[model samples]
Target: MVTRRRLPRAFFERPTLQVARQVLGQRLVRLEPEGGRLAGLIVEAEAYVGSEDLGCHARAGRTARNASMWGPPGHAYVYFTYGMHWMLNLVTEREGFPAAVLVRALLPTEGVEVMRRRRRGRPERELTDGPAKICQALAIDRELDGHDLCNPDSRLFLEAGPGVPEQAVTTGPRVGLNSVAEPWKSIPWRFQVRPEYIPSLAEEEQTP
Candidate 1:
């Protein structure tokens, strides 16, 4: 349903904060193993900058767990969090920069039944509302870590959707950053589209 192609590498290689906001209306597409495509309009994302930024995982420096964040831009940095759910981050800020944008929510756009199955019986709004929840509903996991989102063959890819204007986005402190303090905690790095802009998963009936 997107008129434009997947966002190019140069698009994601820019400043982390810009990428976070720009990704708001993009469509994240997953090529399922069963020969189907499932996608969602990215509704929310958070920017995590460099080591100096306490809210970033790189603040503690690179370990085996966060090495992907240091790799090329437009790569997936999937990781497990809290021993339960996996969170998906799109590595940004170019190679060696170690910055990323955590995709926090999605508005279902395609393959609604596939997402419903993956997410069990959760309500449509609750299915992909949080970082971990989006990961679960999209079948994203550690296996996709470091996957190049710029490559079409990759199971995960991003497509251009309607542009969300600055006025249509709401900015606030990044979520789940309670442990971090001061300016880092207060930076308005979190970006989300207006609630009314989120479309339902129900597709229009087709005429065969």
Candidate 2:
């Protein structure tokens, strides 16, 4: 059973990489306008640290779109990308620091039917298998940009859940950085649960 205890701001006021890994096995929940909940078990995430990281959005400094990243920790940094998809990111580190963790994948545990419907009747395995897919499944968009995740009344918040052991976690380079520079492109900042820990995608979505 997952605890309803929402993660406090202090939980995110840490190194970006640390927050990314620690978020694994937690619960990402969205409370719909009608009071329904769409939640999942966080299983994959990527870290983007500071303005110096070439692969990070803050590399170019703050802008209107990324203003939320410069806000206090424990706030949502939702952004639209590729002219189509909305991505969900959680800001981390101290205020004014542009650091955040990109939530990459989730295992649907609540509101599976709604997720499947939002995902266009896709199978359970495909409902929230990727970053963009997770947003789509949960109906997250610019509306929640900079939303305070630590607020008890917030529609979007994270909950404490089972902690994933180090042995069950894996690290690798983030996806989709073809044009990014070296070192940053290959940095092992992406974190995910080992294949054996997840049921659906373990065999169907093998990774190198």
Best by TM-score: 2
The whole-model C-alpha lDDT of candidate 2 against the native structure comes to: 0.90
What digit string (tens of lDDT, one per residue) describes model 1 on residues 1-208? 3453888899889999999999988889998898998888888999999899999999999999999999999999999989999999999987999999999998887788888888898778788899998888889898999999999688798987776777779999998888888899899999988886554212211212
Query: Which stretches in model 1 have alpha-carbon errors above 4 Å?
Result: 199-208
Residue ranges of candidate 2 with Cα displaced over 4 Å: 199-208
Global CA lDDT of candidate 1, please?
0.86
Quote the positional error of residue 166 for candidate 2 in Å.
Answer: 0.4
**RMSD to true structure for each model, in Å:** 2.6, 4.6
- Report the number of the highest-lDDT candidate: 2
Each candidate structure's count of clashing pairs: 0, 0
Q: Tens-digit lDDT track for model 2 on 61-142?
A: 9999999999999999999999999999999999999999999999888889999999999999999999999999999999
State each model's CA lDDT, in order.
0.86, 0.90
